[model samples]
Target: AQSVAQPEDQVNVAEGNPLTVKCTYSVSGNPYLFWYVQYPNRGLQFLLKYITGDNLVKGSYGFEAEFNKSQTSFHLKKPSALVSDSALYFCAVRITGGFKTIFGAGTRLFVKA
Candidate 1:
Protein backbone atom coordinates (compact mmCIF):
# COMPACT_ATOMS: atom_id res chain seq x y z
CA ALA A 1 0.00 0.00 0.00
CA GLN A 2 1.10 3.55 -0.72
CA SER A 3 0.12 6.63 1.22
CA VAL A 4 1.02 10.29 1.57
CA ALA A 5 0.84 12.60 4.57
CA GLN A 6 0.66 16.33 4.67
CA PRO A 7 1.09 17.09 8.36
CA GLU A 8 -0.08 20.66 8.23
CA ASP A 9 -3.66 21.50 7.53
CA GLN A 10 -2.76 25.02 6.52
CA VAL A 11 0.34 27.02 5.74
CA ASN A 12 0.32 30.80 5.87
CA VAL A 13 2.78 33.02 4.08
CA ALA A 14 2.93 36.68 3.32
CA GLU A 15 3.43 37.97 -0.17
CA GLY A 16 7.03 37.89 -1.40
CA ASN A 17 8.07 35.36 1.21
CA PRO A 18 9.27 31.85 0.56
CA LEU A 19 6.84 29.06 1.35
CA THR A 20 7.14 25.35 1.91
CA VAL A 21 4.51 22.65 2.16
CA LYS A 22 5.77 19.43 3.69
CA CYS A 23 4.88 15.91 2.66
CA THR A 24 5.98 12.35 3.33
CA TYR A 25 5.05 9.01 1.87
CA SER A 26 5.14 5.30 2.36
CA VAL A 27 5.44 2.88 -0.54
CA SER A 28 6.50 -0.66 -1.32
CA GLY A 29 8.89 0.32 -4.08
CA ASN A 30 10.48 3.49 -5.38
CA PRO A 31 8.06 6.34 -4.97
CA TYR A 32 6.70 8.49 -7.78
CA LEU A 33 5.72 11.73 -6.17
CA PHE A 34 3.55 14.52 -7.53
CA TRP A 35 2.32 17.94 -6.43
CA TYR A 36 -0.99 19.43 -7.46
CA VAL A 37 -2.77 22.70 -6.81
CA GLN A 38 -6.45 23.55 -6.89
CA TYR A 39 -7.99 26.97 -6.92
CA PRO A 40 -11.40 27.49 -5.26
CA ASN A 41 -13.73 25.29 -7.31
CA ARG A 42 -11.39 24.37 -10.13
CA GLY A 43 -9.94 20.94 -10.81
CA LEU A 44 -6.58 19.70 -9.70
CA GLN A 45 -3.68 21.08 -11.70
CA PHE A 46 -0.36 19.30 -11.98
CA LEU A 47 2.38 21.35 -10.44
CA LEU A 48 5.38 19.03 -10.47
CA LYS A 49 6.40 15.38 -10.49
CA TYR A 50 9.31 13.35 -9.31
CA ILE A 51 9.67 10.45 -11.66
CA THR A 52 13.21 9.11 -12.14
CA GLY A 53 15.80 11.79 -12.16
CA ASP A 54 17.61 14.20 -9.92
CA ASN A 55 16.30 14.46 -6.40
CA LEU A 56 15.47 18.11 -6.92
CA VAL A 57 12.73 18.71 -9.49
CA LYS A 58 11.27 22.00 -10.70
CA GLY A 59 7.74 22.56 -11.88
CA SER A 60 5.28 25.16 -13.11
CA TYR A 61 4.84 28.57 -11.53
CA GLY A 62 8.30 28.71 -9.96
CA PHE A 63 7.53 25.77 -7.73
CA GLU A 64 10.00 23.02 -6.93
CA ALA A 65 10.31 19.99 -4.70
CA GLU A 66 13.10 17.81 -3.43
CA PHE A 67 12.66 14.06 -3.27
CA ASN A 68 14.32 12.54 -0.24
CA LYS A 69 14.50 8.79 -0.47
CA SER A 70 15.97 8.23 2.94
CA GLN A 71 13.45 10.46 4.62
CA THR A 72 10.59 9.44 2.37
CA SER A 73 9.73 13.07 1.91
CA PHE A 74 8.88 15.41 -0.96
CA HIS A 75 8.46 19.00 0.14
CA LEU A 76 7.11 21.73 -2.15
CA LYS A 77 8.84 25.09 -2.21
CA LYS A 78 8.38 28.46 -3.79
CA PRO A 79 11.08 31.10 -3.55
CA SER A 80 8.69 34.00 -3.60
CA ALA A 81 5.10 33.62 -2.64
CA LEU A 82 2.39 35.54 -4.42
CA VAL A 83 -1.19 36.38 -3.51
CA SER A 84 -2.30 34.51 -6.61
CA ASP A 85 -0.41 31.45 -5.41
CA SER A 86 -2.83 30.88 -2.60
CA ALA A 87 -4.59 27.63 -3.22
CA LEU A 88 -5.27 24.12 -2.02
CA TYR A 89 -2.19 21.93 -2.46
CA PHE A 90 -1.89 18.20 -2.45
CA CYS A 91 0.91 15.66 -2.32
CA ALA A 92 0.42 12.36 -4.06
CA VAL A 93 2.19 9.04 -4.37
CA ARG A 94 1.75 6.78 -7.37
CA ILE A 95 1.76 3.09 -6.64
CA THR A 96 4.89 1.82 -8.37
CA GLY A 97 3.25 -0.86 -10.50
CA GLY A 98 -0.39 -0.30 -9.70
CA PHE A 99 -3.12 1.88 -11.10
CA LYS A 100 -3.92 3.48 -7.79
CA THR A 101 -2.53 6.83 -6.77
CA ILE A 102 -2.97 7.91 -3.16
CA PHE A 103 -3.13 11.57 -2.35
CA GLY A 104 -2.79 13.41 0.92
CA ALA A 105 -5.89 15.02 2.38
CA GLY A 106 -4.64 18.46 1.29
CA THR A 107 -3.01 21.62 2.60
CA ARG A 108 -4.47 25.05 2.19
CA LEU A 109 -1.99 27.84 1.54
CA PHE A 110 -2.89 31.39 2.43
CA VAL A 111 -0.61 33.97 0.89
CA LYS A 112 -1.49 37.26 2.46
CA ALA A 113 -0.94 40.35 0.40
Candidate 2:
Protein backbone atom coordinates (compact mmCIF):
# COMPACT_ATOMS: atom_id res chain seq x y z
CA ALA A 1 0.00 0.00 0.00
CA GLN A 2 1.07 3.57 -0.73
CA SER A 3 0.44 6.48 1.55
CA VAL A 4 1.67 10.00 2.34
CA ALA A 5 2.02 11.74 5.67
CA GLN A 6 2.23 15.50 6.16
CA PRO A 7 3.22 15.78 9.78
CA GLU A 8 2.44 19.47 10.08
CA ASP A 9 -1.12 20.68 9.97
CA GLN A 10 -0.01 24.22 9.34
CA VAL A 11 3.13 26.29 8.79
CA ASN A 12 3.43 29.94 9.66
CA VAL A 13 6.19 32.16 8.33
CA ALA A 14 6.90 35.78 7.63
CA GLU A 15 7.18 37.05 4.13
CA GLY A 16 10.71 36.87 2.62
CA ASN A 17 11.81 34.06 4.90
CA PRO A 18 12.50 30.54 3.75
CA LEU A 19 9.69 28.05 4.23
CA THR A 20 9.32 24.33 4.17
CA VAL A 21 6.40 21.86 4.26
CA LYS A 22 7.46 18.39 5.27
CA CYS A 23 6.24 15.20 3.59
CA THR A 24 7.03 11.50 3.86
CA TYR A 25 5.70 8.46 2.07
CA SER A 26 5.34 4.69 2.14
CA VAL A 27 4.84 2.78 -1.06
CA SER A 28 5.55 -0.44 -2.89
CA GLY A 29 8.22 -0.29 -5.63
CA ASN A 30 9.22 3.08 -7.06
CA PRO A 31 6.83 6.00 -6.72
CA TYR A 32 5.75 9.08 -8.62
CA LEU A 33 5.73 12.13 -6.40
CA PHE A 34 3.88 15.41 -6.71
CA TRP A 35 3.21 18.67 -4.87
CA TYR A 36 0.09 20.72 -5.33
CA VAL A 37 -1.25 24.00 -4.01
CA GLN A 38 -4.86 24.98 -3.52
CA TYR A 39 -6.47 28.31 -3.03
CA PRO A 40 -9.92 29.01 -1.57
CA ASN A 41 -12.58 27.06 -3.48
CA ARG A 42 -10.10 26.28 -6.23
CA GLY A 43 -8.80 22.99 -7.52
CA LEU A 44 -5.25 21.94 -6.76
CA GLN A 45 -2.61 23.47 -8.97
CA PHE A 46 0.44 21.44 -9.85
CA LEU A 47 3.56 22.74 -8.20
CA LEU A 48 6.05 20.06 -9.20
CA LYS A 49 6.55 16.41 -9.90
CA TYR A 50 9.31 13.84 -9.47
CA ILE A 51 8.99 11.08 -12.00
CA THR A 52 12.60 10.06 -12.47
CA GLY A 53 16.14 11.39 -12.85
CA ASP A 54 16.74 14.54 -10.84
CA ASN A 55 16.50 14.44 -7.08
CA LEU A 56 15.96 18.19 -6.94
CA VAL A 57 12.98 19.37 -8.98
CA LYS A 58 11.89 22.97 -9.40
CA GLY A 59 8.39 24.20 -10.13
CA SER A 60 6.03 27.16 -10.22
CA TYR A 61 6.27 30.17 -7.90
CA GLY A 62 9.91 29.69 -6.97
CA PHE A 63 9.20 26.40 -5.25
CA GLU A 64 11.37 23.32 -5.26
CA ALA A 65 11.53 19.87 -3.70
CA GLU A 66 14.14 17.24 -2.92
CA PHE A 67 13.38 13.60 -3.40
CA ASN A 68 15.19 11.40 -0.91
CA LYS A 69 14.70 7.83 -2.02
CA SER A 70 16.55 6.29 0.90
CA GLN A 71 14.42 8.10 3.45
CA THR A 72 11.23 7.85 1.36
CA SER A 73 10.76 11.55 1.74
CA PHE A 74 10.04 14.51 -0.50
CA HIS A 75 10.00 17.86 1.22
CA LEU A 76 8.95 21.14 -0.43
CA LYS A 77 11.16 24.20 -0.03
CA LYS A 78 11.21 27.88 -0.92
CA PRO A 79 13.96 30.39 -0.28
CA SER A 80 11.61 33.32 0.12
CA ALA A 81 8.08 33.14 1.36
CA LEU A 82 5.32 35.53 0.24
CA VAL A 83 2.12 36.68 1.81
CA SER A 84 0.35 35.61 -1.34
CA ASP A 85 1.82 32.19 -0.88
CA SER A 86 -0.59 31.57 1.93
CA ALA A 87 -2.69 28.62 0.90
CA LEU A 88 -3.20 24.91 1.30
CA TYR A 89 -0.64 22.37 0.17
CA PHE A 90 -0.96 18.67 -0.41
CA CYS A 91 1.67 16.01 -1.01
CA ALA A 92 0.66 13.08 -3.17
CA VAL A 93 2.16 9.83 -4.40
CA ARG A 94 1.24 7.04 -6.82
CA ILE A 95 2.74 3.63 -7.22
CA THR A 96 4.14 2.60 -10.58
CA GLY A 97 1.19 0.46 -11.54
CA GLY A 98 -1.56 2.09 -9.54
CA PHE A 99 -4.33 4.24 -10.96
CA LYS A 100 -5.29 5.85 -7.69
CA THR A 101 -3.13 8.48 -6.03
CA ILE A 102 -2.96 8.99 -2.29
CA PHE A 103 -2.66 12.44 -0.73
CA GLY A 104 -1.62 13.77 2.65
CA ALA A 105 -4.26 15.38 4.82
CA GLY A 106 -2.90 18.78 3.81
CA THR A 107 -0.83 21.58 5.29
CA ARG A 108 -2.05 25.13 5.49
CA LEU A 109 0.69 27.67 4.86
CA PHE A 110 0.18 31.04 6.44
CA VAL A 111 2.65 33.65 5.28
CA LYS A 112 2.48 36.85 7.25
CA ALA A 113 3.31 40.22 5.82
Candidate 3:
Protein backbone atom coordinates (compact mmCIF):
# COMPACT_ATOMS: atom_id res chain seq x y z
CA ALA A 1 0.00 0.00 0.00
CA GLN A 2 1.08 3.55 -0.82
CA SER A 3 -0.21 6.79 0.63
CA VAL A 4 0.71 10.47 0.82
CA ALA A 5 0.02 13.16 3.37
CA GLN A 6 -0.02 16.98 3.34
CA PRO A 7 -0.05 18.06 6.94
CA GLU A 8 -0.99 21.65 6.33
CA ASP A 9 -4.35 22.61 4.97
CA GLN A 10 -3.04 25.97 3.82
CA VAL A 11 0.33 27.63 3.41
CA ASN A 12 0.75 31.39 3.47
CA VAL A 13 3.77 33.19 2.10
CA ALA A 14 4.76 36.65 0.99
CA GLU A 15 5.51 37.35 -2.59
CA GLY A 16 9.17 36.99 -3.54
CA ASN A 17 9.77 34.83 -0.48
CA PRO A 18 10.52 31.17 -0.39
CA LEU A 19 7.68 28.72 0.08
CA THR A 20 7.36 25.09 0.93
CA VAL A 21 4.46 22.63 0.99
CA LYS A 22 5.29 19.64 3.08
CA CYS A 23 4.48 16.10 2.05
CA THR A 24 5.25 12.65 3.40
CA TYR A 25 4.57 9.16 2.19
CA SER A 26 4.24 5.54 3.24
CA VAL A 27 4.67 2.65 0.87
CA SER A 28 5.35 -1.04 0.89
CA GLY A 29 7.87 -0.87 -1.91
CA ASN A 30 9.65 1.82 -3.89
CA PRO A 31 7.48 4.92 -4.26
CA TYR A 32 6.82 7.31 -7.09
CA LEU A 33 6.20 10.81 -5.83
CA PHE A 34 4.64 13.73 -7.66
CA TRP A 35 3.54 17.31 -7.16
CA TYR A 36 0.63 18.99 -8.86
CA VAL A 37 -0.95 22.41 -8.92
CA GLN A 38 -4.59 23.21 -9.53
CA TYR A 39 -6.02 26.55 -10.47
CA PRO A 40 -9.64 27.53 -10.07
CA ASN A 41 -11.86 25.64 -12.47
CA ARG A 42 -8.82 23.97 -13.95
CA GLY A 43 -7.43 20.48 -13.97
CA LEU A 44 -4.37 19.49 -12.03
CA GLN A 45 -1.11 20.28 -13.78
CA PHE A 46 1.98 18.18 -13.37
CA LEU A 47 4.72 20.02 -11.55
CA LEU A 48 7.39 17.41 -10.91
CA LYS A 49 7.99 13.75 -10.22
CA TYR A 50 10.47 11.51 -8.45
CA ILE A 51 10.90 8.09 -9.94
CA THR A 52 14.64 7.43 -10.10
CA GLY A 53 17.99 9.14 -10.33
CA ASP A 54 18.44 12.50 -8.65
CA ASN A 55 16.92 13.05 -5.25
CA LEU A 56 16.45 16.72 -6.11
CA VAL A 57 13.99 17.03 -8.98
CA LYS A 58 13.11 20.32 -10.64
CA GLY A 59 9.71 20.92 -12.09
CA SER A 60 7.79 23.52 -14.08
CA TYR A 61 7.33 27.10 -12.91
CA GLY A 62 10.38 27.38 -10.73
CA PHE A 63 9.23 24.59 -8.44
CA GLU A 64 11.32 21.73 -7.16
CA ALA A 65 11.24 18.84 -4.69
CA GLU A 66 13.72 16.63 -2.92
CA PHE A 67 13.13 12.94 -2.49
CA ASN A 68 14.27 11.79 0.93
CA LYS A 69 14.15 8.08 1.35
CA SER A 70 15.17 8.08 4.98
CA GLN A 71 12.51 10.57 5.95
CA THR A 72 9.94 9.15 3.54
CA SER A 73 9.20 12.63 2.33
CA PHE A 74 8.99 14.62 -0.88
CA HIS A 75 8.38 18.25 -0.08
CA LEU A 76 7.63 20.87 -2.74
CA LYS A 77 9.63 24.06 -2.74
CA LYS A 78 10.00 27.35 -4.58
CA PRO A 79 12.89 29.71 -4.02
CA SER A 80 10.70 32.74 -4.60
CA ALA A 81 6.98 32.75 -4.70
CA LEU A 82 4.70 34.83 -6.90
CA VAL A 83 1.13 35.88 -6.31
CA SER A 84 0.25 33.93 -9.38
CA ASP A 85 1.61 30.82 -7.70
CA SER A 86 -1.24 30.82 -5.22
CA ALA A 87 -3.26 27.72 -5.86
CA LEU A 88 -4.17 24.31 -4.55
CA TYR A 89 -1.31 21.86 -4.43
CA PHE A 90 -1.36 18.14 -4.05
CA CYS A 91 1.17 15.47 -3.18
CA ALA A 92 0.71 12.06 -4.69
CA VAL A 93 2.35 8.67 -4.38
CA ARG A 94 2.26 5.42 -6.30
CA ILE A 95 4.15 2.31 -5.43
CA THR A 96 6.41 0.73 -7.98
CA GLY A 97 4.41 -1.34 -10.48
CA GLY A 98 1.15 -0.10 -8.94
CA PHE A 99 -1.64 1.16 -11.12
CA LYS A 100 -3.30 3.44 -8.59
CA THR A 101 -1.98 6.79 -7.52
CA ILE A 102 -2.94 7.98 -4.05
CA PHE A 103 -3.20 11.72 -3.35
CA GLY A 104 -3.26 13.85 -0.28
CA ALA A 105 -6.17 16.05 0.69
CA GLY A 106 -4.39 19.06 -0.79
CA THR A 107 -2.96 22.30 0.55
CA ARG A 108 -3.99 25.73 -0.62
CA LEU A 109 -1.10 28.14 -1.10
CA PHE A 110 -1.58 31.86 -0.65
CA VAL A 111 1.20 34.06 -1.94
CA LYS A 112 0.44 37.63 -1.03
CA ALA A 113 2.15 40.62 -2.50
lDDT of 2 by residue, 30-61 (tens): 99999999999999999999999999999999
Model 1's TM-score against the true structure: 0.97
lDDT of 3 by residue, 1-113 (tens): 66788999999999999999999999999999999999999999999999999999999999999999999999999999999999999999999998899999999999999
Estimated TM-score for each candidate: 0.97, 0.98, 0.98
Cα RMSD of all models vs. native, in order, equals 0.7, 0.6, 0.6
Which lDDT values do the candidates have, in the order given? 0.96, 0.97, 0.96
Better of 1 and 2 by lDDT: 2
lDDT of 1 by residue, 39-74 (tens): 988999999999987999999999999999989999
User: What is candidate 3's TM-score against the reference?
Assistant: 0.98
The alpha-carbon lDDT assigned to residue 44 of candidate 1 equals: 100
How many pairs of residues collide in model 1? 0
Better of 2 and 3 by lDDT: 2
Give candidate 1 regions above 4 Å deviation: none
